[model samples]
Target: MSHHIVLRVVAKLLIPLILLFALYVQFHGDFGPGGGFQAGVIFAAALILYALVFGLDSARRVISPDLLRVLMASGVLLYGGVGVASLLLGGHFLDYSVLASDPVAGQHLGILLVELGVGITVTSTMLSLFYGFAGRGGDG
Candidate 1:
């Protein structure tokens, strides 16, 4: 296969595995040191690498700037929403016990939502940075 074709094929094959590993890190964070932040960076790095191998325009087409902005904002909102929910339930901010009737369930839900938020923010930020750098003629 041609060079471009080979790069595309490799990106296609590797991206999914990278995402899977990110998910694993996010889910197993409680049992280990890595968490949503790490997972998000890993996920974003994979996409950035793909862009580096391909082209900025191609990466932009796949993940639009508008979408990335939204994803980043949504992540912060999700995290804040969890805290607000906790406050509404008469608990300290991020106590997580207010998430559900059962405190443990609330904790689980809080962790999941927070992790998701972190992932979204991290991915979008990294992608946006990549776009900025690549657009400035770094990926020629």
Candidate 2:
């Protein structure tokens, strides 16, 4: 891999742009073409590319398996917590109108939170799978 200086440099350059595009898609989803799911998959793809170029151990050092697993669950919890919060606020489960003083604002807030949760879960899940399969050679 040390001989592959071009690959390393190119990947280093591209990874940040990939992450930025993913974020763009994540935030712009509500009003435009992309959304949480697309953003998450893109995010995972960047990480996978990093793993492919630098090797799995480096990626793992950046985000350990134990921590990724927790993050995966945390996304689900954040989504569920939002629903529960809505319920506690006197709305039905997942009903977004109660999340803020203005119903429209509440809806926007709820949707953003839900999208964030979806993004987190999808990203972590994809990264975990990539990590598991990429290390089948026991490299990591």
Candidate 3:
């Protein structure tokens, strides 16, 4: 097959698997080697791969820089909000015990929220970086 044909085929086959692996990393983080940051990078890489083979314009349509900025800020806010909530509830920063009546359950919840924030921040940062490089005609 020609290079374009091969890339198209490979992208078609690989994207779903990449997304699945990212999800696995996001959810199975507590029990395995993967974690939020890794998962976010994995997810962003998959999208970046699409942009590499397809076009930056197409990728931008899917994930615009403005939206990415909001996402990045939202992630930070989420993490900070959790800490503030903990403090308001009469605990130190990120003290999960104040989040719920049951400390262990609160811990799980806190970890989940923090992991989600980390994942969002990581993914958006990487995507933005990819856009910066690729949009500058680095690939050419």
What TM-score does candidate 2 get on C-alpha atoms?
0.97
Model 1 C-alpha lDDT per residue in residues 1-140, reported as the tens digit of each score = 23788778888899889888988888888888778899999989888877777777787898998999999999999999889889998999999988899999889989989998998899999898877777788554
Checking candidate 3 for backbone clashes, the offending pairs are none
What CA RMSD would candidate 1 show? 2.1
- RMSD per candidate (Å) reads 2.1, 1.0, 2.0
Q: Provide TM-scores for the models.
A: 0.88, 0.97, 0.93
| Model 3 Cα lDDT, one tens digit per residue, 57-116 | 887888899999999899889999999999999999999777989998899888888888
Which lDDT tens digits does candidate 2 get at residues 19-88?
Answer: 9999999999999998889999999999999988998989999888898899899989989999999999
Better model by lDDT: candidate 1 vs candidate 3: 3
Residue pairs with backbone atoms closer than 3 Å in model 1 (clashes): none
* Pairs clashing within candidate 2: none
lDDT of each: 0.87, 0.93, 0.88
Instruction: Tell me how far the alpha carbon of residue 31 in candidate 1 is from the true structure, in angstroms, after superposition.
Output: 3.3
RMSD (CA, Å), candidate 3 to true, equals 2.0
Better of 1 and 3 by TM-score: 3
